[model samples]
Target: MREFDSYPTPEARERELADLVAKASATIPGTELIEYGRSVEHRPLHVVRVPSPAAGAVPRVLVCANTHGPEFIGNRVCVGMLAKLIEDPPPPLRRLHERAELWLAPCLNPDGYARTHALDGVGSLARLRHNHRGVDLNRNWPLPAGARRLPLPGAGSSTPGDATYRGPAPLSEPETAALDQLLTSQKFHASANLHSFMGTLFPPRVRTRADSLAYARLCEALRQAQPHTRYLRIASRVFDTFTGEQEDHQHHTHGCWSVCVECFSFRASLAQSFARRVPLFWRFNPRDPRPWVDNDVPAVAAFLLAALDLPPPVSPRASRTDP
Candidate 1:
């Protein structure tokens, strides 16, 4: 696994996470591995559900990755954290997983990932930000309350073409449908969606004004846990909040502390973006000089652990409602 971690291609990211699920399930007795649904290209939508199943009392948490397809760092970090949790989880994580449930979806857009992997025409593949139908899985989600369309940029945004389309309607895509239903079925204590290329931690639906008190509280918990993170946009609505980003839908609809974290700088930062662009699976040199930080993985892992330890912003309500 460590060998694969050094350099993982986008296509290989799903393959590796699937492998971890299989291994982890076999090792844990009550663990439930479910295929929520299939992607547009028939890529299995897999999630490792670690639940007590005793019912009543335990809350739920969903930790996901690969929702953006090209953002590959979360895939590695999710699996790495899972491994660590199994072997030596901190008190918060151990207890959280033991009492509450952990729903880990390491890859959401397998097709987009596959396309991104062979972008050089090395495999005659062009990356897309959409599912098979060319829809953005994130934007197609249905918000719980009556919310308007996501605030988007221009008609043609520089956003990657791979999978950011909002589709014709909310819950129009299977990926969003599966997640929306699953998340709604039960209230999650907190949910986090992982991404990459931004060396920062942020909340969903950044508002234009001061950090919404709700988001600010969650951000504080994360920042205090790990002081190294580039805590930006503490109180800024996303410039483009049009298409019902998954984070917004999840937080507003379920009233869960829905957070979306960007992990590395392969694309977002010119300073070291070139380094991450190199296929993680491709052989590279430790001695090779690159603008990068070694803390990406640990930083995220610690933040997650801290989240588990912190008290909920409010005593557990039956559920939260926003749209």
Candidate 2:
């Protein structure tokens, strides 16, 4: 068993992911790993597919992490979950694999992750959040061309170096485009884009009553898996929302049920009296990866399981009877 307590740099992270895929393929009956695309600095984006047993067109669920460079906790959670499933899948989990397909993209922003690692260490919170080109990958989705402006106060930024800088145009960044391609190419029943430092599980916008109920059950399943976690229905209200985001694009454009998960929280600044000097990175990511992985990965796994069992969301008109 690999000790996931410490964080890995970009190269190390890629190697770890490769190792995970290799081991999984050797151990699990049907595990496939593919190089989906490349980052700005040419880092290969890898996706691991775990097929179902009853396999004629099973519902696909995407579990992606590390869209934001500094928020690495989700990546750890995802990797841990994959490891668990590969190593010793519980009977229920085995049943899940027998019914639904699982896809995982562990690190989406390799350039930024590597850049941040080059600039700062574990104790230093001065990490880089944007890619090598300084664009925020989360904000670079292919939203309508006009919606690509400086986002509202809490939404996103227009400034290149700023943390929330939405690029000059939608799908402008390669990383976002690569992910966009994946979402658009295949039909994913649901997706969980993992993020961090907030400790909350958010469901995408729920417009209809059926959508609301389905999400409620899904959130409950996640909560049941990790009782300490909080479930927020509309993430927009919490973060004030932004365009070109993965969850929003997945749900709206691709018709996939998607949510951005804030994996774990840690604020070193609030913990000590000498907090004035520590950088923001120290505050954004957890120091040790074990607790966060142990608590949140199961919740993610449970959510995927719940999604498989959930009835498809019905439109308002479809749910209403003509009088």
Candidate 3:
């Protein structure tokens, strides 16, 4: 797990991700690894599927991480579970994965990861929350297209340097399109896109209203499973002011269960580490945040187990269309 913090070069990370996938495919007879699409660098976006070939299974669980470059510890956690499920398949993981499908998008923005890593020496702060185009992958998702996508540039401006810039249009990037294809191709029971920094759990349907209660419930349960994470629904926090979000697109359009988890912090100081451990404590201010040595892996694993046991929620009522 310390490999998660070793800060590999962008190429090394991609190679490691591919190696993990290949190893899993070889180790688990039922698992298959497919390349969804390529990043701007022509690096393959690996989507490892467990028992996707298995027929007659109910809805499956799809967990992905690293849509952004630097917030990748979650990606590491996802990859670890994936490799474990396939490579040294415990009877539980083997049987569960046989009945479930996991789609791990390890390094979704390879171009950004590589470029940023190069910019500041292997895997630096530049990799956080943005892709090669300087756009935030999480913030760039197409909302219910139409005027609802207010403020044109939404939470942030379209300036390339902005952290949350929405691209020219929805699905303008290969990453988004590849993700769309993955969602359309399968019937998923539940899905969560992991993140780090704030340690907050987010849901696609974020409002506190009745229409979104169930979604909130799911998010809360997941967060509760990981005590380190505090539940912070987007609608309540961002006021839908944050437009073009992946979670909303997945929830409103695809009826897919999705979430955005702020996985860890960027601060590296001891004070920062202490604050994260006890956010309520005073006099503990951090500068740059580094990932917690031990992440929420165990809790996240348990949550996945519970989520898979539940049925898929009703998809949004809108006519299905790739966003």
Model 2 TM-score is 0.84
Q: TM-scores across all candidates? A: 0.73, 0.84, 0.75
Q: Write the per-residue lDDT of candidate 2 for residues 95-185, one digit (tens) a residue.
A: 6677788899998988777766665633222147777787878867654222333336635566666667777877778888888788767
**Per-residue C-alpha lDDT of model 3 across residues 235-282, encoded as one tens digit per residue:** 463455536677677766676667776666333324345534432111
lDDT of 2 at 23: 88
Instruction: Give per-residue CA lDDT, model 1, range 293-319, as digits (tens).
Output: 223334444444445555443321232
- Alpha carbon RMSD to native, model 1: 6.0
Instruction: Estimate the overall C-alpha local distance difference test score of candidate 1.
Output: 0.57
lDDT of 1 at 289: 13
Residue 241 lDDT in model 3? 50
TM-score-sorted candidate list, best first = 2, 3, 1
Error of 3 at 98 (Å): 5.8
What lDDT is obtained when candidate 3 is compared to the true structure? Answer: 0.58
Better of 1 and 2 by lDDT: 2
What's every prediction's RMSD, in angstroms? 6.0, 5.8, 5.9
Model 3 stretches with alpha carbons more than 4 Å out: 1-5, 52-55, 86-99, 121-129, 145-147, 152-156, 206-211, 227-238, 265-294, 309-311, 315-323
In angstroms, the error of model 2 at 13 is: 1.3
